[model samples]
Target: MLFFILTTIGKFLTKDEERDRELMARIKARDSSALSELYDNYNRLLFGLILSVLKKREEAEDILQEVFTKIWENAEKFDLEKGTVYTWIVTLARNKSIDRLRSKVYKEQKKQSTSLNDDDVFHPLYSNESDPLENTILSERAERVHKALNEISEKQRKVL
Candidate 1:
């Protein structure tokens, strides 16, 4: 009984690549701390990889946030037997960033407003008489989300 207890405690205390694998398993099982460790381990490298392609800081930052959001939301879909955690995350970041890049360009083109003298004209979404309360509510919501974001750990905050 004594030997069994000691071995159990010893195994619990050990930290290695296998521990990382276990953490990933926990993350797959819906543990949030494992998601934090996953972010701390790969955020910078993945961000740099995205920044290389996106070139714009804000766009890259948005892509980084989106990549990790998808990772945490989809952690259960990962299979350690198929690839290393690093490879899996990096691949996810790369794919998401590329998709963002493509869609961003499409959105920009769609939103372009031409001068009145030209064939196109800008038609605003809201008229000059639009309610100010709507704008105030949107601004307040943005501030609340920003404050809530600050409450999270730096590891999780980096991607955001």
Candidate 2:
């Protein structure tokens, strides 16, 4: 009886993994409906996890959206040998939230630095005023950088 119950549970888990794999395959094909289905299946659980990490509903919501956007973008990179779909997504949410927290701390430190003595302040060569010509050049440079990054393999990009 114990062997039969354990085998049945294993089969159920395998079926669940197979379903998640199929959803990921469809997402990689640019199927919006498949993404929607994935969101429907995982959003509540992911949201709870994000909310637990951030403790702010608004920021948690934003992170949840970012997590799904990442899922959509990186669907092709999923590997069964690495882990299940659930594990991958939960890791993404946790990492994103931690990043957001770190960014908030960095921004706070920057704000504090602005209050330092004039002699301690580090001045930049450039002004903050917007210039159309400079803006265009910066935009083009950003696009080039983005394209260059996309040309590299995901593993290499992650290492960078």
Candidate 3:
């Protein structure tokens, strides 16, 4: 009994890569201190990886938190045979940063693909008009729409 207790206690007190894997196993058992320890150990390296990929301090900071949260959530799925804890964490940070970068790029591409006249969609149709003239033009446009709607068949109206 004494030897078994000593071995059990010794397993919980370790350092380096072996310690990290043990922490992950403890985290999978919902031990908060192990999660905190893992974060304390790897946060800097992961943050640097994220920053290099994103090239923005704020975005990198956010991604680092996201990566850790992902690790915490997925702790139960961690496989020691696959890789070291650092490799798993680094991969998470890199993948998340790359995903965020891709999203920002996609949004920028969408903006670029938009027509240059896109602003006109929201600009006053009669920016130069007096109040009365603007109202009149709006009324005319509304009337035209009403007329066009009336001219359409019920099926066409429903489709529109």
Candidate 4:
């Protein structure tokens, strides 16, 4: 009974994957309706992911729109061998959200630095104060590097 249930679940998942592939093929052919259908299927989930990253409804909405726009423009680049359609779209949404977030942080930093006068430079070239955004970015980069290092052989990882 357990084997039967697992097999049935697998069949349903395969059908969903086939449907996603069909939609992607239509999108690659420049079928706007297919794009709309894809958006309808994924928008809520993607929007929730974007909003979680951005923590702002308006910015999340903007990023979600951009994610779809990218999907529309780059449909031909999709490769099932690399990953499933769901993974591709989710990655696009997450990346767009992160890009927007990084830009916002950079803009805020630029604005703050520009507002400082010559007298502000006298404090020190470096300070004990930490910028939370900078720390977050550095930590993320470090985590990614650590993951990548772990993926390689020990010799290669040690050399890097």
Per-residue error for 137 in candidate 1, Å, reads: 46
- Candidate ranking under lDDT, highest first, comes to 4, 2, 3, 1
Report how far residue 149 has shifted in candidate 2, in Å: 37
- Mark the regions of model 3 whose C-alpha exceeds 4 Å error after superposition: 1-15, 114-160
Q: lDDT for model 2, on a 0 to 1 scale?
A: 0.71
Q: Higher-lDDT candidate among 1 and 4?
A: 4
Query: Candidate 4 regions off by >4 Å?
Result: 1-15, 114-160
When sorted by TM-score, best at the front, the candidate numbers are: 4, 2, 3, 1
Stretches of model 1 off by over 4 angstroms after superposition: 1-17, 111-160
* Better candidate by lDDT, 2 or 3: 2
User: Candidate 1 at residue 61, lDDT?
Assistant: 88
Write candidate 2's Cα lDDT for 1-160 as tens digits: 3223323433344458778889999999999998998898778767876676568999999999999999999998988755567657766886887678766655766888754433232222124665332343355457777888999999989988
State TM-scores per candidate. 0.55, 0.61, 0.61, 0.63
Q: Model 3, poorest ten-residue lDDT window?
A: 2-11
The CA lDDT of each predicted structure is: 0.63, 0.71, 0.68, 0.73
Number of the top candidate by lDDT?
Answer: 4
Residue 100 error for model 3, in Å?
Answer: 0.7
Looking at candidate 2, what is the lDDT of residue 45? 69
lDDT of 4 by residue, 1-160 (tens): 3223323433344458878899999999999999998888878777876786688999999999999999999999998766567667876886787777766765765888765443343232224676343443355457777887889999997787
